[model samples]
Target: MTRTATSAHPLDVALELEPVGDGTVTGRTTAAYANMVGPFGGITAATMLSAALRHPERLGDPVSLTVNFAGPVADGPFTIDARPTRTNNSTQHWTIEMTQDGVVATTATAVFALRRDSWTSTEVAPPAAPGAESVEPTPGPEFIRWMSNYDMRFVDGGLTDIDGERGDSTTTLWIRDNPARALDFPGLTAMCDSFYPRVFLRRGQMCPAGTVSLTIYFHVDADTLSEQGDDAVLATARAQHFGRSYFDQSAELWGRGGALLATSHQVMYFKV
Candidate 1:
């Protein structure tokens, strides 16, 4: 099967991966993924992880995953290399690194669970779900420019400026898997890294200062693309902290009827 790259929004284009000899590969990204932090913000460590894991032969089965952001990223084609840490009948461990313009930009390590094994169940109730039609999507080319990977639709109060005097430090968004290509766990994780700012906009903050790290948890894998055809993926984010030059952020994902889907957290660096 041919692997297709997935985007978080329309402007977020997934650059095709090419071989660079050895155990390395290169991929390009559209400027939309750069965020307001110039051509180097929000490009995330997981983005590199996605590129590294794009090869499914390394993953035993899709399950739970965690990524640690080691550093910053820049615009243009990036390179990634994956090394297997361990592989068992039920799980796989990996160490991945991302390079931009021949410079090491970020590194990550992850644990991916497999589906073909017996395991104990340890599921917990997710956080509260927000109103489906109350939270809205950001509008205009400036905001829209940041979201070019996935297809998005407004459900509430967006399309205005995020100049700090808006609503609260919280907002919800409905995001779907980009149908332009076939997506997998890493792709979804990469997209998860892209969903934010609804909480920041309420504080009238523009441009990301910097992120110390980003983490995501997958409660259920969104394997089938069509599964989300009729269901809307709700993403709710909160600004944990806004300090002199950095911010702590976290977000949760829910299904149409409020099922806990996934959760994400990150430390971001601003442009101020």
Candidate 2:
């Protein structure tokens, strides 16, 4: 499914395309979504649950997802919705929504896994942050480009600098996604995942692999686009757990000025 911009400033969802369901979607709360001081935050859980609701079919997919917390999510009224945007013989796509106070807080499109049997492997070094000289921020119009909400500067020496040192498992960078985009919450949420891979390299290990899966949870429906001015957001992330072939990363979201905004997490499977 394609993404669009919406009016909601914080918990926004962009439904540029027509919404297929009139009322098939609703919002709910889990312990994780409850507002309490703990590892998991409600805003992130709510955002994630809302995203999952976008594609009910995924509930049946073999893929499993877990969302960790960087901070606490606000408690408020939130909305969730989804619709099929495209379908073909081989695969299907859908969009997700998280809304509150008549605004789209977060929106995302998920492509369901379809070809489990079709398998192939190739040699590839994991995508790593380029050296300080090479990792300059490429700002542009593409969604992947650094939007106006942030001012991201690679930490000196690169994430690999901490190799095997105490606190080496952590990766820090400069980020500021702020000012608030007036109507593009989903697009803002999408960017949250874009920088996730950087945290994995904090260990400074050679991760000559790819993300088998990725999931992002929004912690306050506070997805700002260009309208919010030049506000900034910072992300501090670390690997929470890892196995021989898989691992998870947790992140904290901070407004550019240093106020805590939200928390997030992702589960990754290294390509074997």
Best candidate (score: TM-score): 1
Q: What is the lDDT of residue 165 in candidate 2?
A: 33
- For each candidate in turn, the TM-score is 0.71, 0.42
Residue 208, model 2: Cα distance from true site in angstroms:
5.2
For residues 1-272, what per-residue lDDT tens digits would candidate 1 score against the true structure? Answer: 12254534332345456767655777776665556543333345445555545655466434444454455455566788876778877677777777776677777767666554346453644344455445443443554455664545544324353664664566556665434434445445655665555444755655544555677676664454325443456666667666677777777766544556567787776655
lDDT of 2: 0.42
Q: How many residue pairs clash in each candidate?
A: 23, 25
The models' CA-based lDDT, in order, is 0.57, 0.42
Which portions of model 2 show Cα errors greater than 4 Å? 1-15, 20-151, 156-167, 176-184, 196-228
| Cα error of candidate 2 at position 11, Å | 16
Task: Give per-residue CA lDDT, model 2, range 1-272, as digits (tens).
Answer: 11244543333332222223552354433332122231123234335544544444543221222333322223444455655566666555556555556565455455443444444342322223333233454342333222333345554324335354344455545443332443223433444444534434554554543343345433232333233333434456667766777777666544433434434566666643
